[model samples]
Target: MRIKKYSFLLLALLAISFKSFSQDTTQYIVANRKNSLAQQNKPYVILISADGFRYDFAKRYNAQNLLRLGSEGISTPYMMPSYPSVTFPNHYAIVSGLYPSHSGLVNNTYYDRARKDKYLMSNKAKVADSSWYGGAPLWVRAEQQNMLSASFYWVASEAAIQGVRPTYYYIYNEKIDMHNRIAAVVNWLKLPPSQRPHLITFYLPQVDHAAHLNGPESPEAEKEVHFVDSAVNELQKVVKTTRLKNVNFVFVSDHGMTKVDNKNPIGIPAAIDTSKFVISGDGILVELYAKNKGDIQATYNELKKEAKDYDVYLKSNVPARLHYGTADDWHNHIGDILLIPRAPKVFNLWNNKKINPGWHGYDPTVVPDMRASFTAWGPAFKKHLVVTPFENVSVFNLISEILGLKHTDKIDGTNQLANKVLIKKASKKK
Candidate 1:
């Protein structure tokens, strides 16, 4: 009996030792796997912006390429644009991590009396000024982190903002060949993984061009959206079938278009003192350069009282709900006051019988008119997941999450979608 008891005690001690050793080994393995995953999950992020694409239009017009991309990954069903709901303001909002007002891109064209200059983001000269741009784009941020970055045709790309330039970019070519654009991107991806870009932006203007030329509902517009879809599909094929390695893709648009039934004039040429406000190109938006500080409110109130055909508000009086940055540097580029008309109504300054088809720049609060198209796919995204009613600011947060980087600037968005979709559940909880 003594011998049997001793034997049992020895076996128990050995089993206990083995159990502790096994626990230690399991913990180490788990930790190492997590570390490995962290290293492996760094993704090459691609941002695709198909200008003027509406939310419902994607499904209504049967965008098979977009639908297929969604089927292969995750998408936010209907993403709304920033206030004013114009392409320039909203697209600037996405990459800069700021709203239109905060980013100093309140409208496509706005007046600034301080420098006695008119700021148009499309103007290469205006964009060249770093102070004019509100914040750093992801490309500049990536460069700061010593990661490779490039842009195919994003706004402010040609500008030297934040003292950083993309590794590769086009010079705002309106007549750029789509195939050549795709080939340039593919060539960049073909570089060695170490030298390859971590972030890239692809802008497809054909759809937006077609939409503006042939109305968003026209068969020509449908064909344009499909053309973009085909391009996106081609990109998918290149990324999937190649040795490009780990990657992530985000597809988005600046704003949706609305059909106009009336020639609604937001402001009359006779209403504003023409000497004070030169009707800028494309009368859809106007810039008022105050001759002096005293002239600011006068110009503002005059337009407000007389331009009843539009909704006029001062840049200083911009709605707090929009979350514009309060810094002094950002305010100068904004007009003393902005004018935007209600839907089915467009600003009358730019009415050229030659250039009418479809348009944007309506108030963002109007839901049906404000909705834009967006989708995210690839290894970093969850397959076939649906996210609804997220804000445009959420995009910045999502991109930061994919690269395993953190941005402390308080934005209107978060990385909740990534956690909801991409993060894998632990088999057993800690």
Candidate 2:
């Protein structure tokens, strides 16, 4: 009889211990979440994308603050980019939940010389025309569902290229107005809870700018990261004080940078007759629009076969695996062919500068070329968890889950994976 009683006591103690552990884990997750004034709070989602941010740079620089979020929440081992892995292409992927090809943006710029129009990324005359865009971005989707959304500096945020505009948006300008852009976001959050957007996006371009000029590991790049980090920390403080505890912030980047090797020049003489084609932009990649398609094939062919130092392919033949498909919308409409130079080297045709320090747009498949990092922390996530390799599109699916919105089309990513980032699993299933 005594043995039976002791066994029961032991079992009860074990149950208590397990319950304690479970509670501890749950508390840990909540501790990281911003506190709220009310018992029930609306969920919030914030996405911050840093241009030209590479994955390993986080480790190399000992980004403890960033790693803390990952350790406390879920993080992707390596997130692949959409084909062409450039800023515009991959940024479109993050919000649309589609790869670059499907999103209709293939490169930074596209040339429709035949129509006498060039698709450059400026706010001047851009519109949310249906022809140039594909699928809906997170803001558009949220707006369709009658939810509020906002964007700071995403590529399409300025143009409203798809009939979907954020509740608030800013014109894209890196130097003229970046802080004001961030201020607008904070101001929106200060509005009444009902008026505040459930979804918000913010972009920082300084890092990419420094990287392009000084190389990825240069002192300028370090300063850019730290400056951005300070800004992010400030934003976090604001969320905690405001009634914005419901917000779930996600920090991510478009792609990483590779050092330029100026040793060998892939000599494809300028194909433009100057009278027929116009060239724009400077650096590793040059944007050109030709009045004649005939020259495009010859120029493209030579770049592919003879241009050993560069990986050249026409818009149609861009590798499918990159999720960058043939031209279907405005994003992919311009470039007839893309020239991606390998690492330790970047292309230079436009002013033909002797050497360029840094570059992106390489095939993401090059393991060393993959850039960017992702972190999330909030009630909507699964805490202290590690997710397997994921793609930028997954972020869209995850946001949908947090907001309880439905996206009808099939996307490359899923909320199921993102859920692993901020929430804690119960010790025992109910």
Candidate 3:
């Protein structure tokens, strides 16, 4: 195990000088690219994300397909997402091995002081722009080494970060049915070895939409969980027709959802002065960006004075363990002042719009409900294994190890997860 890791680590680092672009496009491809002969033979990985799937959803909803597959492989009690466990940040964290703060995606919608612009998840222009993203995402790393990748829709998958997007990918769209999506994967697998994707990302959004619209405990949420379970079972069965070997599935969720106190939500804090600071964030958390750095302390103190259901802090004092403080904000995009509400309470900035019943974006360390789910099943994994909860960043290490792709940059994740869940042979390249 050590030998394989050491070999990958010792190789001369690669220096890339190419440029790429990603606009409002779908069924995208990077022309003239073919997986290196060495990479064409690597084991296949289908990384699927069932958004808002709680750790216990399968068992609670009796998702027999997922339960059986998980029992046949490895399932952790739960996987802790990074602080402020929201979709975009945590999903990007999973692929990049960097916390949301480190990755510069502090929230689903955040203002970058340097760029003087806000990146909203709803804005397709910003979503497709690679400049907002940081760190070497899994697809970027794979392509850097000449291994092709594909994505059906996941955070940063559409952006051409580091001048590389997945070789085959579609921009985010909800219109595609499960039948067509599975067929696309099947077709990709049937491609010639050199043209086939070694790494593919497939996302399922039904669970999250239901959980957010109706409370996670509601019938609609439970129905979506079953839907995802049946969908995965169908996907696996269809892929089996190809009779291909070494196809692995890492079923995961970005973050879990919990019922919040929407009826009596906290309004915008009186301490915030618009002239002195710019504001961002929503019900789960509120961020105040100070126009002048010296004003931060006073605002933080004032917010603390009026603070009731929420906790206020200067960016410098954000919990060190959460890696969200000023020191850890690699992209300088984090707000100067942050307000984190206690669970069941969320910040209502406008004091007008109705808040959702189910919500996330709390520190997972303190709110267990924010924790996500993870299960590894396939030819590359050891049979019937269970391990303790791990951080979402650890997934970056696991994928690289499985595909024998070397990472030239430093990452927050380590080989600990890969070593524990993957069999020894996983480290040895085919």
Best by lDDT: 3
What are the per-residue Cα lDDT tens digits for candidate 3 across 298-382?
8788888999998998888888988989799988988898899999898765434556788888888888888899988988898
Q: Which of the predicted structures, 1 or 3, would earn the higher lDDT when compared with the native?
A: 3
Find the candidate with the highest TM-score and give its number: 3
Q: Write one digit per residue (lDDT tens) for candidate 1, span 118-138.
A: 565445566556666776777
Candidate 2 lDDT over 1-430, as tens digits, reads 0122332232222110001111111100101122223312447788898777787666666666677767776677667776666777688889888776566565555444445554444323432344556777888777666667777657676555555577666545444344555667678788675566778888877777777778788988888777767677777766777755466778888887777665564543444344544543323444445567677887776555666655666767766665543544335344565665656555445223355566676667774555567777766676787777677888887777676667777677766665565453311111
TM-score pick, better of 1 and 3? 3
Q: Report lDDT per candidate.
A: 0.63, 0.62, 0.83
TM-score of each: 0.81, 0.78, 0.93
Superposition error at 337 for model 2 (Å): 4.7
lDDT of 1: 0.63
- Candidate 3 local accuracy as lDDT? 0.83
The superposed Cα distance between candidate 1 and the true structure at residue 231, in angstroms, equals: 0.8
The better candidate by TM-score, 2 or 3, is 3
lDDT of 3 at 251: 95
